[model samples]
Target: MLVRLAVIAAALLASTGTAFAADAKRLGRYGEWESLTYTEGNAKVCYIATTAAKVTGGEKGKNSTFLIVTHRPGSKSNDEVSINATYTFKKDSSVELQVGALKHSLFTKGERAWAADPKTDKAIIATLQRGKEAILHASPAKGSDVAATFPLSGFSDALASADKACNIKR
Candidate 1:
């Protein structure tokens, strides 16, 4: 009986360790991500969070959207989400962003370019960053840079704000 109990304890410990390792790997690769869509003048800017799954593109290696996992601080429930923002690099090295059904192009050479939702005509600008994680910031763009640098913390806030402003429940 003693030997059997010891074996069972070892098995349990191994399983627990595996579970923790899996969780850590997931968090490290993809921090929580959110999607947002906002407008500037007549252009609409869409923001999406990139995920490990999409980034890796499976074993076949296909281009895919980013993925986000969200959990409230005190809530027991968690959610997995994704964002769709089409990007096109311009001849001038600027980028165009299309979120959901809205579209906007940006030029960061001079000051900042104005974007607006075609439907609402609300003006906004987006800042895109790519490093360990990809981040896009959507704001009024009036006094903001079309392409600005931001830290990881700022990226999280900008993502959340885009979700709120774009009326994206997911």
Candidate 2:
């Protein structure tokens, strides 16, 4: 299931222009996370991602859900956080990520959610780095709210692989 999700996510990011990569190469898999890199025009794109460890929701079409952090050194974008909920989000609704006491709200569009700004993205990444797990609470367009827990094991190594691959400085 995870392998399928990783493939789907890579394809989706490429097609949606979020990853900005025409072809992605797998760097390695660390625990539940995978690091990938690709070239987009002249820039290099790198990201680490993981699928949900546990998904508890009544929402249908809850497949291929995952969380990602991308780095685009050419664009000076780093630690850009995004989530694929696998279901169209409720219009104008927000998704909340909880790691310990840290909580962040991400703006939703279609099946994806992203931090409103780079600062928020940084904070969320920091929280993920320090927490053992992250729980995402989201509202679907056609069903009850859904909550997914993503484990943070090996997240640091995965992010490091992406950072090195993209030449992103800490």
Candidate 3:
């Protein structure tokens, strides 16, 4: 369907690690999350995207912040996690993500952060499904330390939409 293709395209764009506006269709919305897909480079990509419920500290820039779980069929990086931190990270500093009682250390580059490996990505998703919320502690290059909170409500449903949209299992 046209709408489905749009969702795929949007997801692809979201996970691309670059800044760009998407002109795509949304597949669905699950609580605080959204299911999106879109076309890029002739390939379909699906992802679940959400914004933080609250953010504190860190000097302002564009202040564009969000999280994404993306699937690119037949690619090595499928089911990856990406975060837009809204500010460039300190050189060689990692972000700390706390969900419930678990904590994960994420690698950072510029204004983005992500799980260090595919296995970690899967683990983060699993935690997202069962945890209350996610709070990320980060240090920006030019500002004070920051903490961003993202609610876990509807994460499972959002992931299901992404999986179905991209023909991914689990």
Each model's lDDT: 0.30, 0.83, 0.77
Global local distance difference test of model 1: 0.30
Output the worst ten-in-a-row residue range by lDDT, candidate 3. 3-12
Which runs of model 2 end up more than 4 angstroms from their true locations? Answer: 1-22
- Between candidates 1 and 3, which one is better according to lDDT? 3
Look at candidate 1 and tell me the lDDT of residue 129. Answer: 22
Model 3 scores a C-alpha lDDT of 0.77
Candidate 2's TM-score = 0.89
lDDT over C-alpha atoms for residue 168 of model 3: 84
How far in Å is the alpha carbon of 87 misplaced in model 2? Answer: 0.8
TM-score of each: 0.21, 0.89, 0.86
Q: Which residue pairs of candidate 3 clash?
A: 7-36, 7-37, 7-38, 8-37, 8-38, 9-37, 9-38, 9-39, 10-37, 10-38
Ranking by lDDT: 2, 3, 1
Top candidate, metric TM-score: 2
